[model samples]
Target: MHQPLDIKDKSSDKNSIKVEAFRKHVRTTKPHKHNNYFELIFLSQGHGTHAIDQEKIDIQPPMVFGIGKEQIHYWDMDAEPEGYVMIFRSDFIMNSHDKALLELANELFSHSHILLSKDESITQFFSLLAKELKELTVSPYVVEGLLKALFGKILQMALHIKPTQDKSKNLYQQLVDLLIENKEYDRKVENYAELLNTTPQNLNAICRKIENLTASEVIAAHIVKEAKRLLAHSNSSISEIAFHLNFKDSSHFVKYFKRHAQVTPGAFRSSSLIEKRN
Candidate 1:
């Protein structure tokens, strides 16, 4: 069994945000999943493969990758990686109650990665962010404000660079959006199909075309992702997690987890705890 590494930011003040150059840190290059924070990585120079949720993406310079919390991922860099890594808790942006900001953040998280070319404005923003991170006396609000501006700019660039939209792709993106939004209460393909005003077969076909996975698999994957996050990061018991995820019974939840994860829920939790301790 491959245990996913749980990486934590151990800043002295327990700050909700962290920004640093990627090559400065020396750590093992292993498969891992972040616990509760989202990651935005800017790669200015690198050649490698980035695996996210079973999808392998080729590395290209001047690209940005956005990863939501608990998404399994790893890096295999053929050469030294160089760029800035910005990590911040999801609640840090959600709690702001700025609807536009929240929507932009959500949009960025919707994609596995975004391709970019060197732009002077983006470069200047990153430089400003790096400077702000060095000034320990800067207020938290100031830092957060800067982050919001950076995200806004990224969102704008993404909008312009997004590939031509088609009906099939749009529907597929909607399915993904709904999966993230309603992972707890609704886990049925038919339910999502009806919500999209399409039949289950049609929905499945769209999903297959977009991601090579059926609609049911997509829903199950999101549910399992959330379940793992709760097991690893929360103090919730197995029964509690089952209930929270709308599982009818703990036994059924265990079976489902085992079927996909190749380990029972209890065993997974125990291993996760042991990993944390080490």
Candidate 2:
């Protein structure tokens, strides 16, 4: 069994040194986090809901799934799906000159970039990608070249993506950066709008235009995302978790969690812990 991606610090020295791949079951998924490794899945088998970030999609055969370290995701298994999951340390491509591509690769897998495309060319590219992964297991030089190609493919797809527009996106991204950096979940939109030198309405309009997300949507995203993190890791009480998240009350936090996640906070926490122990 494997720990949830959240509990293990993928950025730790332990995850920094190796590239590994194998088949794994859903039981190993406990809402864990990945901090160091960039992961890709050639889910040749399996059928179920694959929850990544806020996107929940069904897993069909031959899907190319990407997960990054910061994304808290889970597989609620159904139909006994089995697949190949490959994890490689980020340092494996640390010295590459193609900063944009490498960063896109990391971001795509790390969950920062959660959008996926239904483009036809992606299928052909992934065919080559799967073949390269096979070669990497037997040849280091081949693996290195594959890594570079993988990075390039990531950028190519990203460039072709239709931007997710939101109305107050400038404020949203800024506030998201602010909250992520400061570790505050309850910050107001006005706070961000004020800092951006715009009215809340103006900021909200931009985020909605850019991402189809409202100012509140952006805020709730940050809060719920972090709540998922705490639920997966620390064995803190619901009340304590509320306090840590700066919620006005435990009930408010619980309601917020359920609204965004479709589960009570306690349920999510307990489910993650049980999955890890199983």
Candidate 3:
């Protein structure tokens, strides 16, 4: 039988932010999930492929990989890797009270992999960020400022490399950001509309215009995607996963998952395990 998925809790009780140089090793890792934190991996050097969920991305140098809070990913490296890994939990961004920064972070994490140019400034930013975090006398404000600059520079580079359809912040973009930022597991359009301070009808219109899906459909897609990730990547029991997603109970979640995924949660998990084993 295949082993249970490895769920890593990298967050410490005290600090919500951390930075460190990437471990140098030539390896393949089992499919695993991280708990309650987003990781940004900046690799100035590396080779092989990174599997994020169902997509396999080639690892090229000078690239930034954003692993979302609940994504299932694994590394398959043919050569020794050299880089830095930056981790920050949701609370670090949410509690900052900077909506723009929070949205920017949400956008950054939305993309699984972003190719970057070989700019010395990017390396310098990471170097300075690591130094600030390592210094015992460094103030929290200094660390936060450095982080802001680093993320801003990365985002700018990502946009320059590949621009999205609409660069302006619209209602649809705000809704997308709110869905990711708010971890309430609320799949209701009315609740999201309330949070967005708009009517459900208006929200639905915007979603249809942007994604060709209704507002309720969009919310359900987000919840179902997260549910699938947990089922496939975490060792959490069905009941535990249900509670984590704020479902009324396991039965309700099972029905929801079956309806959307067209497979029972247990069967899905079993299949995921089988695939990994092969």
Candidate maximizing lDDT: 3
Predicted candidate 1 versus true structure: per-residue lDDT over 1-278, tens digit per residue: 23335565433346677777786343235556775677888877788789776567898867789987657677877777778888887667767756556656666676788877454566667778878877868676776677778776765665345433345765775676566667465788998999999999999998888778888888887888778877775678788889888989999899999988888888988997896576
Q: Which residue ranges in model 1 land beyond 4 Å of their true spot?
A: 1-13, 24-28, 159-221, 224-278
Which stretches of model 3 miss by more than 4 angstroms?
Answer: 1-4, 97-100, 159-186, 209-212, 230-278
Give candidate 1's TM-score: 0.60
Clashing pairs in 3: none
Instruction: Please give the distance, in angstroms, between residue 82's alpha carbon in candidate 3 and its true position after superposition.
Output: 0.9
Off by over 4 Å in 2: 1-6, 10-18, 24-28, 35-38, 47-49, 53-56, 76-99, 106-148, 151-182, 186-206, 228-236, 248-278
Give the least accurate 10-residue stretch of model 1, judged by summed lDDT.
Answer: 1-10
Order of candidates by lDDT, top first?
A: 3, 1, 2
TM-scores of all candidate predictions against the true structure: 0.60, 0.54, 0.76
Better of 1 and 2 by TM-score: 1
Alpha-carbon RMSD, candidate 3: 4.2
Give the distance in Å from residue 164's predicted Cα in candidate 1 to where it truly belongs.
Answer: 14
Clashes of each: 0, 37, 0
Which prediction has more favorable lDDT, 2 or 3? 3
